[model samples]
Target chain A: MARVNATPRRRGAARTDELLEVTLELAVEVGYAGLSIEAVARRAGVGKHTIYRRWPSKAALLLDALSRVWTADLNYRGTGDVRADLREQFLRSAPALATTPIGPVYRAVIAEAQSDEALRATLHEMFLANVEQSTLDRITRAQQAGELVPDVDLTFAAEVLCGALYYRGLLSTRPIDEAAVDSLLDMFMAAYGA
Target chain B: MARVNATPRRRGAARTDELLEVTLELAVEVGYAGLSIEAVARRAGVGKHTIYRRWPSKAALLLDALSRVWTADLNYRGTGDVRADLREQFLRSAPALATTPIGPVYRAVIAEAQSDEALRATLHEMFLANVEQSTLDRITRAQQAGELVPDVDLTFAAEVLCGALYYRGLLSTRPIDEAAVDSLLDMFMAAYGA
Candidate 1:
């Protein structure tokens, strides 16, 4: 599927990736409140116009950077066992999300999204596309397979489970360890498991 | 319980309340990023030193202002029916938290808390003290009264329910309506109701 101009496209993608890597690092260190395009440009060794050409606002850049960093490995193919699938999915991401280095970046983007409409939309769209909708799809599949209760509101169930992770990530001082994930799964399954 | 010098103490409290009123108003208008003690003081017609004398940082002031504004009506006395109590509690507040004027302020404080440790501490402490711990106590009482299952993790349950509110408030564009609150209650009760 290589284009005739694949080299240029690949180079552009690589450059974009490098800029996002720096964005993630700076977002962790200074947070969204302190993040700026000029600062990112200086750090990433790119001109301000280069950054501005791609993203209209700092929020837009952070939105893209956040999606790049957070949703990089979020490929969800549901296992037959709903509990196992959910546990595996959450265990893979939630702990890393609670830990520092990248955790603050996730937190910062989420925090900044509150005030910025475009960032909020991007964050919501990214979360729905990458996380929520995928979860609902799995739940639906599980319901059809008789692994989950068919009567459960899939959206509510998904929100409840994912909301706990978001809560722990953004608010709690304690790290989201396996035990916590286990409890969350237990609560989730006890309600919706067939 | 009025003292002879209650007038001066009341005056101090009134002054703080006025300052926080302006803080909440500006927070709604300009958000946490644009909010400053100087601006708040200017709006409230107070000296900068007067604002600084009481609050060391904007985050502190916002923390206080947020608590003052948001936690004003969080009356969570258990009425023996755990489900009904929780539903009423959430239905009353979630809509308000989702609506504008105050919703953005709540969102702003939460957003600022991610990068600011002191604000995070204040937010966490305030949440635990005013919201989570109280919810846990109600859940415990429900367990004792045979309204809720004995073995559910109260903390996890509280977090899940409150987390949904937080998620919807800060992230979703849709309001956390009565039906949503009812569904949330049904989900919570399904897992924990005896």
Candidate 2:
């Protein structure tokens, strides 16, 4: 999304996708700490300015790549059962973050964000905030439909839902499977289910 | 705890404590990525071998230091009201992770653990597993006292509880305040409170 405007109209999106793919590959190979704009350029066969023209920094570039990896698979089904919708979405989308390239690179980016405030802000705005908001949106509709208990604040619930998944999926060494998701959703439903 | 036996006589314990304190100071000052044995040794007024003799790696040293910072707090009190105890313990214990010299340093170590399996195991064994298990212990007593639903798996609940706190407290840029803690417990009680 960052550099989408600069590339030529046709094949531009494809080229951006390819560049991002390469970025992820390189991130996996050398790690986020070792990844550089110069290295990305060299590997992608593009000029350094070309990479820099779109992304302001290495974090920015990798963030975009992470966004691409995450964007496609995260849509919730809203199957009318908020719990089921959440469970479905969780099973579908959460595993990618656990997989290689994304997990390690994402962790490194998160690590770097600890020291770099600007990167932290961007990471939240571009990634985590989106996930959190999408979750809120799903549960909000369910609450309005009376699938959830009336008038209780669900924002923290959303955070806990997504946060638990993210923590288990990406941050920790544990694997989140169907049984785990079922237990989580069961507790969630016991709390919020109407 | 690692190098305690290596030191001799009455001052041995004090020297170990001072070294761990210096390690933490260095972690905060240089950032974990830039922290080194030489840096810690030079800052602590000790030889490099002396620092290395106790901990095999920088991660090992920092992990031990983290153990010290975390050791003094984190006990969960059984007030006969599980929710109150949880809320009280959360308020007392969770803030330290959100504070400087702990939050940032802990995040860096967690990030490093993402790539390093040994570090991940050590972190879980020493730090996170303890937190998770302690939460479980607190909740298990409540369940046995008939304060929670019978025959339900509380392990995932414990994970979600601590994981959400850790996520919001350490990982995310968001602040976990009293209101947030109340909201979290509200949902938890709704789910599990009997």
Q: Write the per-residue lDDT of candidate 1 for residues A61-149, one digit (tens) a residue.
A: 87778677667346565668877777778877775555687766777777778777767777777554467777777788999999878
lDDT per residue, candidate 1, B1-194, as tens digits? Answer: 47868999999999999998898888888877889999999999999999999888887787778777657446675677888888878877775555787777777778778867667777777554467776777788899899888865677777777878777766776678887788788877777879
**Chain A of model 2, TM-score against the native?**
0.83
Q: In candidate 2, list every pair of residues with a backbone clash.
A: none
DockQ of candidate 2, scored on C-alphas against the true complex (2 decimals): 0.55
Native-referenced Cα lDDT, model 1? 0.77
Per-prediction DockQ:
0.52, 0.55
* Residue-by-residue lDDT tens digits, candidate 2, B1-194: 54775556557788889999999998898887899999989988989999889888888888888878777455788888999888888878777665786778887887767667778877876777778888999999999999987787799898898888877864567777788889889989999988
Least accurate stretch of 10 residues (summed lDDT) in model 1 chain A? A70-79
Q: Encode model 2's per-residue lDDT on A2-84: one tens digit a residue.
A: 47855665576776788899998999998888999999898889899988889898888898898887885557787788887
The TM-scores, one per candidate, come to: 0.77, 0.82
Q: Could you tell me the lDDT of residue A68 within candidate 2?
A: 87
Best by DockQ: 2
Tell me the lDDT of candidate 2.
Answer: 0.82
